[model samples]
Target: MPSLPKPRLRRPARGRGSAVAHAPEPETPNVEVVEHDGLRWVNIVQPRQVDRAWLEEHFAFHPLDYEDVFSRNQRPKVDEYEDYLFVVLHFPAFDKQVGRLNAAEVDVFVGPDFVITLPNQPIQPLEYLFTQAQQRDDVRASLFGKGAGYLLYKIVDDCVDASFPMLRKIGNKLERLEEDIFEGRSGEIVRDLSNAKQEIINFRKIVRPQRSALADLERTKRYIPDDLDIYFDDINDASERIWDMLENFKEVVEGLESTNESVLSHQLNDVLRVLTAFSAVMLPLTFVASIFGMNVHVPGQDSITAFWIVIAFMVGLLGGMFYLFRRRGWL
Candidate 1:
């Protein structure tokens, strides 16, 4: 809730005979500032609160970097500048309306004294880190005491770590789906599997690109300290691991889908086979009964027991057809 000291542009001292007027400070509503140990962490939530004008006036970020802040759905990337590094990263967020996880972009400006984060939406990980930084002295010290680069790393690390719980939820769903598939209780299992697959795909789409960005960060070694390469390397490794897990889940989903289709096909074939056998046996009996019912029947029409005889013949014919059908494996 605390605010950072308002930044100002320095000017030459006025002459003794001169008078000066000061410009009113601009209003910043979407910006949240957390200051610790002479370090400033500024978080910008959305585009409407600040634009290119504010960004330029405050941090003087590159035109392209601040231009990207107004946009949405940016690809993950890292750009190194003379005094700072501009990094765009995506974090996973669950969209309850869509019933799937989606990627939210976070644009970071890492400088010597401050780290600024601009998110397309209210990102949970960033909010969580902000809260921790405010309440936990250890977290504040570790993040701010080190440097801006380390603080940036901590934010990114938390973002990456947040995916694990989502992934675990997906894993649990898949496990239940697998059990349902084997137990032949596939009611709604297909839909569940589909949902899980979509989440995995969305997660992969969101995260796979970030691995390259993280690797670039590690290789560039521009914003972070030299000793912090290991931390970035570890993050890159985690990205790879997460990607691999998603790929495996994708394969499992495909296999399960194939199996489900196969089972459904087999069951349909069995029903068709039974229907065909019944139709085959009934067709001849119906024909024979129609023939006997005709006014000018040729055989066994006048005998007192002729009705019984015809019924016996029809029964024998039905039995013979069914026997042949069964022998041929049609039923």
Candidate 2:
């Protein structure tokens, strides 16, 4: 087997008198090279804004790629430059107390010799990958140098895979809510379900564009090497799966919402029915009492037994009305 050539170590640029003159503006950290298993990787962490002069002096990244690093809140997508490929992806994290998905953006630059990752917000998956890379030399080599393209694959794959745990947590919550809805305690459950739906909707908003972006990348032949195409396919497939899960979750939530509304409506109808029945039974009694209380002379008002007669008639009327209502199932 042929031996891999040793990777050249490039020192950071310094000013005259070797007094490490920090660039007036912060420079994106230079790539850190790690080698193992005959592969080399140059990992670039969060990239900061670089002046044109600094870019010219320090590295050979395309000006447009540098422009993308400074671009604010870019949608997930891919761009092919003459010398490298640019990709943007979002990863999901949980806001535990709020119970929502917080997506973080990661912009990547992959070239023949280097891989640069820029994250606008805290992304858990990439941090996990970095930790793993630190622990495993072989994994570090596979990510850093065997192919810069492979590093892009690892980062994206890890991001996509991290979504599963979040999705599972949402699924379990949905299940618990489903039980609550069935148990006739849907007020709190419905509200929580609504929050979950919103989170899923937000997640879909973030992931759907990435799906199209990955699909676009898959079709392009300019930037992705033929051998690396499979990795992009994996990313696309993962995007599709995430989208499908979100869609299913949306449908479930809509169904649960409908069910919650139905239950509330039914309970309200029952209350209204009971009130109507009570009013029906009381109507005749009220009419009889009103007639007896009037000052005008009436046959019932003339006799001492009239009061007893009215009372007996009222009782009989109320009983009959109740019986009729029960027979008709209106009560």
Most TM-score-accurate candidate: 1
Give the per-residue Cα lDDT of candidate 1 at 107.
90
**For residues 8-61, what per-residue lDDT tens digits would candidate 1 score against the true structure?**
677768888888868786665566778888888988787564454556667667
Alpha carbon lDDT at 13, candidate 1: 84
How far does residue 273 in candidate 1 sit from its true spot (Å)?
A: 0.8
State the number of backbone clashes in model 1: 0
* Error in Å for residue 214 of model 2: 1.3
> Model 2 over residues 59-161: C-alpha lDDT tens digits?
5677766676677767878887777677877677666777677667777766666565667655777877877787887767667654666666787788888
Residue 115 alpha-carbon offset, candidate 2, angstroms: 0.4
